[model samples]
Target chain A: MTSLPATTERRLGLVIDLDTCVGCHACAVNCKEWNSGAQDSPLSDVDAYGADPSGAWLNRIHTFEVTPEGAPAQIVHFPKSCLHCDDAPCVTVCPTGASHKRSEDGIVLVTEDMCIGCGLCAWACPYGAREMDPVENVMKKCTLCVDRIYSETLAEEDRIPACVRTCPSSARHFGDFNDPTSNVSVLVAARGGIDLMPEMGTKPVNKYLPPRPKTNAATRTDPARPAAACQPDTPRPEGFLGWLDAALDRLG
Target chain B: MHPAISVIFFTVASGAGFGLIFLLGLGFPVGGGAGRAFAVSLAGGGLAVAGLIASTFHLGHPERAWRALSQWRSSWLSREGIAAIATLGLFGIYALVWMWSGSRLQILGLLVSLGAAATVFTTAMIYAQLRTVPQWKTRLTPAVYLSFALASGWLLASALGNHAAPGPWGIALVILAWAMKWAWWVRAGRTRLADSGSSPETATGLGFIGKVRLLERPHSGENYLTREMVHVIGRKHARKLRGLALALGAVLPVAILIITALTNAPAPVNLLAALSMLAGLLAERWLFFAEAEHAVSLYYGNR
Candidate 1:
């Protein structure tokens, strides 16, 4: 089962819009909250409330500064999770049958029971997509919210992955990449979505839309138009005061 | 690339142990005749078993380790585990046959020879097949491993053989293994960040944006990915360790072997040569893991 299926019926993944993301980390927080106690969950924390709290998180938001030649700098928020590559090296390198990709959907998952936690799957991934649960002694990864995405118990509108559903800027979109007309596929085509580390040749299912260029006109400050203030309509003040106010108005 | 101590010892001990098995299977004249198998069965077999036990210590679930052998079809780690088991099984039969019947079976010897070499090859492939680590992703990785296995095995063979002078073939194998190791060091020296074509620009998919810089990290504290993959050793310190490994693992053992060939061979001196080789190669194996830079570290700007 560690050997990937030749082809999946569908390639379900995400398309993240860097231009729209606000770097709030809401998606990452919600993902952790939802996964920690889901059906197959309990992503443990190393230090909960101590000086430096660290834990196993399936999603993380990285912020990068991009400076184009002779162009203003742009700050982009990159939220990374499992890309679920078509040629996922993580799945093949697993010595146990725990790491696998679904044949029906291209989502790669780890069956916690069978994982030996040898960390080979994590090592094979060029992207840091997998983590070991220090407390649970098992490999933890983004399951694309496998439990919530297919649950009949949840409402119809709430079936998407926790990260996609909780994105405040609507930067994250989840759909099947196999469908040419899917929302993600359409967005990727329109925005020139790209794979991170394409030279790795993992054929990642997730796509990232680059941040749009910001020109001078977009960033320059605009002067405000003057507006008349309400007048009391009272008789003019003393001659000197009136003359002073008129002089200031002339200067303005 | 974190050089876990358990894995370092496992590779060093088992590498030499299996090498000795390969030589034994070929009926190399180690103290000649009946009891040779029994002595080696204790020395080489004990070291191999110790190394295997040490390997399990690094696993998160040692009790579930048996399941690792079940996925040999695609995983090199699985293949290594299965090959190790088979090699040891074959060596066991070979040893017992000689002890019980005073007859060395040619078929069993040939099987052990193939099995031992296969086990070491699979072990080397476990590291070489990882494309995420560019330094270990070459055919030379296995070549280095095989040569070291043979050279270290020769050291033990020299110690165990009854001949007054160590064989020229043993000395030749040692020199050959060091030459390969020296070549490996030169190739790996610049491999940390250069020559891999993977840079921070390539890693973030922002090469067209002029340049990319890390403005903020995902977390302030250490995570599993960083802890496991981003082991940083100072360049100066690594250079010194390489020197230590080369001196102890190669130069000293060769000098001792040459001295034995020219003069009377003290059994103690030969034993010292084998022990010295083991100690030296341990440093070499440690450096092997310490110097490996994972491609995933590019994401964190650590590579």
Candidate 2:
């Protein structure tokens, strides 16, 4: 059962836009809120009101400072979770039939009932996607909101991952990547979305849209002028200007 | 990666046990007069079983461990579980037949010995197959494991043997294991593959645009992933431990083993050598996990 299926009928995944993410923790918070009450593997927290609080969360957002050669440094907000890789190592490494990828939708999931919680699946995942819940004593990861997406009780428009639905900047997109006309696929094609750590050969289903290139006007700004130029070295003028200059000098 | 004590104990103890069983299967029954062979067998089997049980103690659900044996088709861990169980079963049968019939069942003994070897190999593969820890994904991982196992087995056999003089084979195996371990350290230290492949740029798919560094972590507190994977050992401490491992595990054992063989020392000397080697191997095993950098650690700037 650990062996992966030869193929899936549809590859459902997420596409995130780095250009628009605002580094807010809404998606992660919503993920915690929804999955905490999920039908399977409900998330739990330890030391919630104590000195060191920690909990299980399916999604996390990170902030990074990128300094390119010959380019100005930029801050990028990065949200990360399980990519539900086509060739997920976590699935293959599970000793029990706990970690498995669905052949129907290509979504990797952990069967809590079967899991031994040996932590091998977590070790095999290079992306740190899996977390062992201390309370349940089972491995937990992003389920791609399987419950919400397939729920007949929910409205059609609300049938999406909690993270995607709660993203304030609309940075997260969800759809079937196998469908060429899917919104995620179109976005991937338009923005040149890339896979994270392709060398790992996980064949991650999620694609990340790179930050958009800086505008010409921003890039073309003169670098030679010193910012101190706003305060002129010329002697104060004789009238109101002189008085203003004296006030500014006193403040400085 | 954090070097869990239970795991280190499991690998070392089981490796020696399987190695002892392998030697016994090869028809090298302890030469010491009466009941020595039975005692040795008991010791080996006890060590193996105890190590296995200890391994389950760290699992979140030890009672569900039986399920681990069901996924051998793709999981090295499953293969290991199967192999260990098979090896133990065959060893038990071989022991019973030897006790009742007073004859070594050559074919069954051989099969059991091969199963022991297979168990050790599967154990090695559990770490070697992991792409997440590049340092462990190497041919040397298994080589070091097998050689060390065989070497420890020989040392234990020499100690338990009735003969006054130590065998040359024990010393030779010790040297071989040491050399292999040395080669592994050199390769692991020199190879760029051991370096972290996942960077901020790769994690965010922003390398094409600029150099990337972590400005802030996702949460204020450590999560399970960080607690389990993002281990950081200081360079100075690592170097000191490496020297200690080499000296205690390889150098001292080889030297003591050579002295014992040359002087035709008593069985106690052989026992001393075996104990020293086990101590060294324990340290080596600890370092093996402590030094391995998981790719997930890149996100935490631990890499």
Candidate 3:
């Protein structure tokens, strides 16, 4: 069962846009809040209040500064999690058949009961997607909010993942990549979305929208110049008469 | 790439045990008597079993170790488990036949030897198959493992062999292993794969725009990924360890074995050669894990 399926019916994945993300950690915070109470609940933290605090988190955001030769520097915020690849190494490397990719939805998941916590799956992952829960002593990773996405009780709009829902900039998009007309697919095509580390040959389901190129108009501006001081047009009048005229004009 | 002591002990001890079994299986039918052969078999088997057990010490749930044998079709670790068990079973049958029938089952001995060798190969493949660690994803990795196993096996066998003086075969094997390890070092040093294929730019998919560098880490403290994969050793320290490994694992053993062969030295000298080789191999194994750079470390700015 650890072997991957020949093909999945639907490839549900995320397309993250780098152009508008503010790196506010909202997605990561919402993900922790949701997954900590949802399926395989309670992502515990060890020494949370003490000197050394650590815990398992499903999504993480990293910021980078890119400076090209003879070009303006740009800041990029990268949110990373499991790509749920077509050929996930973590699934194949699991000795207990614990880690598996769903043939129906193309979502990679781990069966907690079957896992022996040997940490082989974590080693096999190239993206650093998986994290070991120090308190539970088992491997945990992004499940893509499987429970909420399929629930009938929640409203249609609320059925998306917590991270996607909580993103203030709408940087994360979730939909089926298999459907050409899907919003995610259309966005990907329009922006020329790219895979992270394609050389790794993971065929990751998730894609990243590159930062939009900065235009010359946006970066261009005119230099400031000093203005000549104003002078009174009628200065020959007597002081009382001038003062009265000025005061009458001001009042008028 | 933390080089946990449990795994280091497991690989080294198990490799040496399988190597001894490989040699003993071939040598037992030819010259060694039943009693001595049985004793040697017990020692080798015991070492291998102990190593397998030691491997579980680092696992979160040691009680679930039996479940690891279920996924042999895809996982090298699972295949290693099955092969180790099969090797033990085959050797058990061979030992029983020798004890009960007082006859060496030549065919069974051959099968057991093949099983032992296969087990060692599977163990090596566990690391070799990992594409995430480019240094380990090579044919040279397995070659080094097999050579070291054979070299240590021959050293141990030389000490226990029935002859009054140790054979030259052990020394020859040590030299061969040394040569192979040296070649591996030279090749690995020149290969780009030893570093990460994924850099900060590639990891973030922002390379097309410009040169990418980490501005801030994802978290303030170390996470599981950093703790498990991001190991950094100083260049000078690594160089010193490599020299130490070469001296203890190959040079010292080969020299002692050659001296013993020339002087017809006593059994103690052969024992000394085996001990020295083992000590050297331990250092070598430690470096193998410590020096390996995982692709995941790119995200952590370790590259």
Candidate 4:
């Protein structure tokens, strides 16, 4: 069993660099793999490898077409998941002692055995991080892979979370948020990052590095034309082939 | 703010139970049949308990119900539970007083019963005050809850009045409650929808300037929407259901009660009105829950 880190005033967390992120969804996939077989497997699916596949994942990618108010640009991909907020709404809303935020690490966690799966925590959460496990009939969410990050048996460099460890693009960083000198804290201070839906007042611990200034100067596309462009204006050719062409052209 | 069915039923049932007991308590000194008061109280109490039991079904761990009463400071549910228990206790005490003595403790019973019913009224306001859900936020909710209880309570009292009191008094209370319910329905129908934090325009802090389309949802599948707001009815179907609830719950029952009252109808006719009102109230309660749209639905790209 992995022993949790020693007592601390405030627990550390992640600062994801959205500018560096390629919207790969690798973090989400690996997180599912790690949590599914871990001590308290956090990931769950309603119907997997079938029609209407659905489940809970700690990390999720949301693509948002962010055209800055007055600027001409392309759509920006926005991936959102748990920020593991310092003032988590999920923790306060839990009727049972199921959802909690640890003072030691600032990590929001759900105790499986205690969870009644009332779906209250999910409602409380604005980010939609928590999910219900149909088989276990309890709530599940990101622990930030607490087991691997704190285990003394692991190498010093390998003590980071699975998502941070596996991030190929080096977009995610994990360290002590309490320490001002910490790498994650420094990067946040230097580069102006933003929290998703900050107006919701969650005070999310994780900081998303804002989308970089648009680089493609030549390729400026109108934001509204994508839906309109999907329709074809030209008529078809002839008989059977013409009908097939019309169907094919319509899908363009 | 997913309003559990148990809680909804509990509020409606207990409200009616206490309302009936209060009105009966008002005219207790005029000594009549012992069985009459007992039957009305039992009917009212049965409906109230039925609602309480229905709410327990919504609990994640129904076995841990006892623990719910402990969190009185923070949880409205806890306060509701305590208030409900107090209501039941008062009802029991009143029942015993009516059985053991004549009209000795009638005033005290009336005071306690009215106090308990007022507490249930506060419980209804708890949901109504939630600005997050525009449907519940309306002042009409408390009025509707109060009217429904009064209507049901009087309807039951009318049944008991067949043997106990003069026919006109019971019919008058029923008519008053019936009118109150119709007025409530009209006000609630005119109530406007509140803006919940569901839209991307609201979520992103961006005004409704540019057309903001959902490129992707954060998760793959149903997290809470498929669970809480899973109930879906088409616009036509919803319209039909609303019409049915209004006709049966408010209009039809009121019409039946008025006809009975005006015609000096028999006991069975009055009983039929009570039964019809009960049936309509159940359908009305169902619509109240189903029709409520949570602001959270906006995050799922629902307008």
Give TM-scores for every candidate, taking all chains together and pairing residue i with residue i: 0.94, 0.92, 0.92, 0.75
Off by over 4 Å in 1: A217-252, B32-36, B163-167, B234-236
Model 3 segments more than 4 A misplaced:
A217-219, A222-252, B28-35, B163-165, B192-197, B233-236
TM-score of 4: 0.75
Ordering by lDDT? 2, 1, 3, 4
lDDT of 4: 0.64
lDDT of 1 by residue, A139-186 (tens): 999999988888999998899999999999999999999999999999
Write candidate 2's Cα lDDT for B1-303 as tens digits.
888889998999899888888988888745543366578788778878888988898899999999999999999999999999999999998887776667778999999899989999999999999988888888999999999888888788777765444466777888899899989888778653335466666766788888878889999889998888887653337877887877888778778877877776776677777778888888888888888878887788766
- Model 2 C-alpha lDDT per residue in residues A46-76, reported as the tens digit of each score: 9999999988888988888888777678998
What fraction of the native interface does candidate 3 get right in terms of contacts? Answer: 0.83
lDDT of every predicted structure (CA atoms) = 0.86, 0.86, 0.84, 0.64
Give model 3's DockQ, 2 decimals: 0.74
Candidate 2: regions farther than 4 A off: A216-252, B32-34, B162-165, B192-198, B234-236
What is model 4's C-alpha RMSD?
10.4
Q: What is the lDDT of residue A218 in candidate 1?
A: 54
Error of 4 at A121 (Å): 3.6
iRMS values for every prediction? 0.9, 1.0, 1.0, 5.7
Instruction: Provide the lowest-lDDT 10-residue window in model 4 chain A.
Output: A1-10
